[model samples]
Target: MKILSLPSSIGLASKIAKNIGCGVADYKLTRFPDNEIYTKIDTPLDGEDVVVIGNTNTDSDIMSYLFLLDAAKEQNPKRLIALMPYFGYARQHRVYNRG
Candidate 1:
């Protein structure tokens, strides 16, 4: 299994990787002048199990996570696991009033 982490979750991911005695994958993220996101996975993940760690605190973070997930899926890994330390808006499970 391989571990991939976003900038926000690097620390946590490192700890997990150390505990599990696994190596972390290399990836790069860049932003364009127009505020677009780009992701490049440097490590090969073909037929390998992958775990992506990220936190969703804002719209940009969410977008980055989605892009990362899509990129990972494109690589056709054997299995994909998402570890979200913080998931936004997950507590609003009820609707008190309907419009």
Candidate 2:
């Protein structure tokens, strides 16, 4: 099994990997000159279970999550698991801004 994560969830991923005695995949995140996000997965995931963790706290974070997931998928892992600790898009009994 392999675990990957963004900055928002790296600590949690580390705790999980430590508890389960699994390996954590190394990756890099950076921004392009035009301010676009970039992700690079540095571990092999072929035929292994892959788990990605992140929080949707902001637009960049969501983008990072998507990029990480796409990067993982390209590796052709046996299964894909996504762990979203905080899904910020959800709303309850509160009035949203004027539409």
The list of candidate 2 runs beyond 4 A from truth reads 92-98
lDDT agreement of model 1 with the native: 0.92
What tens-digit string does per-residue lDDT give for candidate 2 at 1-99? 999988888899999999999999999898999999888898999999999999999888888899999999999999999999998776745677765
The models' CA-based lDDT, in order, is: 0.92, 0.91
Give one digit per residue, the lDDT tens place, for model 1 in 10-98. Answer: 99999999999998999988999999999999999999999999999888999999999889989999999999999976766878787
User: Residue 59 CA error for candidate 2 (Å)?
Assistant: 0.6
Alpha-carbon runs more than 4 Å astray in model 1: 93-99
What's the TM for model 1?
0.91
